[model samples]
Target: MKKILISGMAAFILSLAVPCAVYAEEYMDGRTENGTALSVQAMAVTEDIHRVVDVLKTGRMDEGSAGDASFWQLGAGTFSMSRNIMEAAQAQAPAGARLSSYTQDDLYILAHVICGEAQSYPDDEQLYVGSVVLNRVSHPSFPDSVSAVVFQRGQYACTWDGNYYREPTPQNWANARYLLEHGSVLPGNVVWQSGGRQGSGVYIRTRYHCYCY
Candidate 1:
């Protein structure tokens, strides 16, 4: 729903004063390649909020929300939409569903990092790259967003050595999407990976790297 920003949903995280008592069901159903049915009809008052929620659940949007102002309204609705959708995006890992927490840009950033750091590695290892990134996002010591963690100073060689700039292949996108949708396969505490850098603990080891907490 990138069209959401263009549709007038600006950054209101810090400025928003409205109290949003958003409640969402964490369980998703109607197993399909798309997504589950949301009981979000209660919140779909605005045309844009309805549209955005439908896209998240059904995997279809008339236009990219990023470039269209009609996709979502600005201000209070933005906070409501984002907050509720984030709660809606969460899923049990074994459910194997899309989290929808990462936006298009967020997915692109994640896919790029996965490709950059573990392209040549085996499937499990490549997937591990994404798990590690997600781990860092939830960790106390790292930034809270995917882009921030991937681009943080001295955190990854790929970001500074030009590897991060390479075009991510479809497989890279698949891996990133898989991790986000299905929840990370790695443990939440397993936040560190690869060589040189140190971690508090080790959890798994593949052909190319050690996954650590």
Candidate 2:
């Protein structure tokens, strides 16, 4: 009886250990995939960042080809607009985190970082604001830069309230910077909040019918 009981206990322990190990491996694999996705997105965003910078430096916009478009439609205003956008996105970050470089990796990182931040806002508005910002960047009609899209005239409530450019708490900025540098987007189409226009309705798409508080 003693031998049987001892054997049973050992088997139970082994079973638990096996699942735990498998779970850990899965978790690590997910993390690795996430990192790769973010890196790819960041590269794309970095290219757009460079284009925006070039347009800012030279008043003339580069329309590369029929398929290619410049960072922003209005070439003359890109410098100031892009600067404002970057400042606003930077503000959304926590205090210590300063934008080191606008790399392709940065774009993927920004999406995850912003999504995390968006979680703090009311749940009803999180997807709305997130989708709006993402769409603004992904869409060719809007400025290719994240900063420009966030701070455009009357887009974000945070920007309108002057919080968009305000310095973030140091810890928050550091966390945001880390995520932007390391995070990736999960698979799925980005979703935005939908409802009647709240304040900055003009900047959002009507189809979603989402509102941001």
Candidate 3:
């Protein structure tokens, strides 16, 4: 009887230790193995919008919309989507490469950094525009919502030009989505044209300010 009790306790301890050992090994392996390479999907129109709405709801909204409502009608929805994108990007980033570290002003700065890297317009434009639009919505001067900011007359250049601001092509949208998800601000203090003639192109100020034509 004594032997059986001792053996049972040993087995129980061993069982517990085995799982703990496995967990420790997995964590150590993850650290040594270069964390899983994330195959982040490009932001599709539907997917991106959905992500934005989820974030906005977490931050400021109560409940989202019911069906295919008007853009303005789904203001909180838009904010939620942008917020979701930022949060997800922050999650996959390496240490110190998070969008959340930046303030709204910092986000404005990062938007320029992202735009500078863009190789396409409109869809690529939307990434920056979407970021900016979220800023405005969250800011005091704007309507306090993503859809509101985008639909506001004369607010976004693309909207005014009838660009439709639809889903980006696969490649361009992928690049934009990646930047939105993973781009970070390097250490520096510089300003590039957010918009203008030179501003018409994307601008970056790292290693001195430059624009992508």
TM, every model: 0.52, 0.30, 0.28
Put down candidate 1 lDDT per residue, 134-192, tens digits, no spaces: 87887778898888999999888899899988988888889888888877777676778
The numbered model that scores best in lDDT is: 1
Model 3 misplaced regions, further than 4 Å: 1-127, 165-167, 171-194, 197-213
For residues 1-213, write the lDDT of model 2, one tens digit per residue.
733543354344334333333322322223455433433433343444455444445645434553123333322233333343334333332232123345654444334434434524443333344444554455455666666766567445554554444443444344444434533121112223344544322222334343322
Arrange candidates, best TM-score first: 1, 2, 3
Separately for all candidates shown, the number of backbone clashes (residues 3 or more apart, or on different chains) is: 12, 22, 11
C-alpha RMSD for every candidate: 17.2, 24.9, 23.1
Report the C-alpha lDDT of model 3 over 1-213, residue by residue, as the tens digit: 733543354344334333333222322224433222211211222343454345344443333463323433343443443344344434443231223332444433333323433324555343443344334544455564434545567644444554443433465445434444554232111112243424223322223223221
Winner by lDDT between candidate 3 and candidate 1 = 1
Which regions of candidate 1 fall more than 4 Å away from where they truly are?
A: 1-100
The positional error of residue 18 in candidate 3, measured at the CA in angstroms, is 57
Candidate with the larger lDDT of 1 and 2: 1
